[model samples]
Target: MTSKIKGLKHIIYDLSRINEWWLISAGFVLFAFLPYTFMHHGRVLDIEMFRILFTDPAVYIALLIVFSAQIFLFASNDYFDRDVDALDPGKRVRNPVCDGRVTLAGVRALLIVTAIIPLIASLYFGLLAFLFSALAMFIFYYYTAPPLRFKNKVFLDVLSHGLFVNTFPYFFCLVALMDFTVGTVFLLFAIMMRSTMAQMLQEIRDYHIDSQVEKNTVVVLGQKRAIWVVFSVYIVLFTVTTCLMLSYELFGWGIPMYYSIILILAISYIPIFRKLLKAKDYNREIERLWMGQGRTNRWQVAQYFASFSIYFILVIFLIITGYS
Candidate 1:
């Protein structure tokens, strides 16, 4: 009985290491459902848009494809970054492949399964969906693959990160709505800019391991300069978004909820900006306090809080405005 219990415990632990549960959960939230929910509320007054977005098989299939591609991309990153991740204090705790809880072969098999799902989803959707899905796949492949590996390059790393994290989500939302309005395009660009800023900051947390790996933008640019880059981009984004919000209000198209989201994002950036200002040095001390540890935690918390608040406020506004 004791041996059996131990065996069961081991099984459970191994299952946890697979981390598919977390990935699927995130995919469902970020890709599969959130966009549709946002559009359903934002464009609720337009019955035709609602019907096209919610009832269309193409949109659903596109979401499926996006979800699958994300999973594969994540798994591939783990596969290639296993060595670097093993050395990363932040990554070591949960890195399945490096911890020996998950095998390369297993991850490869999972990637194959993930890749196949998108292809099947594309078949059910339309040619447009298929083409978009292929583009996402290519981006993921180039991100990890050699020669043109954008992950190792400075500008390309940021661009690729923006594309996968921001562009893909925006595209997913637009495709769901089946209508590409100016408002939708602006929202997409805002999301992309925000994601780019966040990703640049993230490099600070992984600086040590990334430096050892001799790749990643933070390593190439050095810490102080990297932080400056992060700050500059976000500052620009904050300015542009603020102006857009003001314009939205001036045009009488602004919902209170949109303003609320803008305010929240603005507030979230204040501390980050302060950190950038106070950063006098980029050695281990600054890296430890700002980059190595605290900044990542703060940024992650702020990111989730801001994103959730935006979605929640929008939904509430839709309901209150009698759109839903």
Candidate 2:
């Protein structure tokens, strides 16, 4: 039993390293999932819903489905990117798959195991949940794998992510709650805008390695152009969320929460820009700041998520208190 436990611990450690936990946190895990989970419970807090989420087997199953989907997606990407990861001289090469800490076959097995969980969970959740999971899985697979690797493509890469990564998860939660309505459309678009910002920033940060690997992104538009892309996307996102907050005057919290999100975005990137302006190697500095594995990454990451996290917490509080 002790040997079994040790083996399992080793396996979990390996998975954690390869999972790219930082990317998951920055990508869709934090901002998108939390808000949507709360929104599903009538866009306000309900103790019963919270209880159900914790104590109910179905809720656990749904959560497992989403978690497994993310694992499968990341694991597959790890497998596919191992070569490029090996090529990357930066700390990005710490990837278990690239560093020989885990084998390709091991990752493949992990992906297959995780893939099954979502399928089983989907069966339990009903057709809508099943459809959302399936579509997300398909897009995620094609996003990194294949003759049609969307991640290597420009517009399709970000657009597919906007749909699968950001939108599908929210829809899955809505299905679990059985609360599909017109207002949800606005919420979906709002989430899409935020997701796009994350995706564009990621692409921009990875410009050097990705360009060497011949992966096309807005980076193909060049560094200055890519920076502009990020800035413009944020502006549009800020504008849209402001409009959304105003449109949904939910007891006066919406405006402040959205403004807080904008503030966080501004705070997070401004320092990076200021540094970039004075840096000898602007791209390298930007990459370090954005990726957050280096010495200064934490400051950037904390600033980036500060206002967003607060907004999320505020929403959760409002929901729990039954505030509109």
Best by lDDT: 2
* C-alpha positional error of residue 45 in candidate 1 after TM-score superposition, expressed in Å: 5.8
Task: Say which candidate scores most in TM-score.
Answer: 2
193-233, model 1: which lDDT tens digit per residue?
A: 76676567667656766777767778878877887887787
Regions of model 2 farther than 4 Å from truth: 1-11, 14-49, 166-168, 178-187, 249-282, 294-296, 304-323
lDDT for each residue of candidate 2 in 1-324, tens digit (9 for 90 to 100): 987675454345555443445354334333333455566677544676566446656555655666677777767777777777776766445566777656677777788888778877887868777777777788877888878889889888888877676555555666665654444555566567667766776776667777887666666786667666666766776676666566557554344443345545654566766675456554566667665663346665677568568768875776567654
- Give the residue spans of candidate 1 off by over 4 A: 1-63, 176-178, 252-262, 276-324
- Residue 313 C-alpha lDDT in model 1: 71
Q: TM-score for all predictions? A: 0.73, 0.76
lDDT per model, in order?
0.63, 0.64
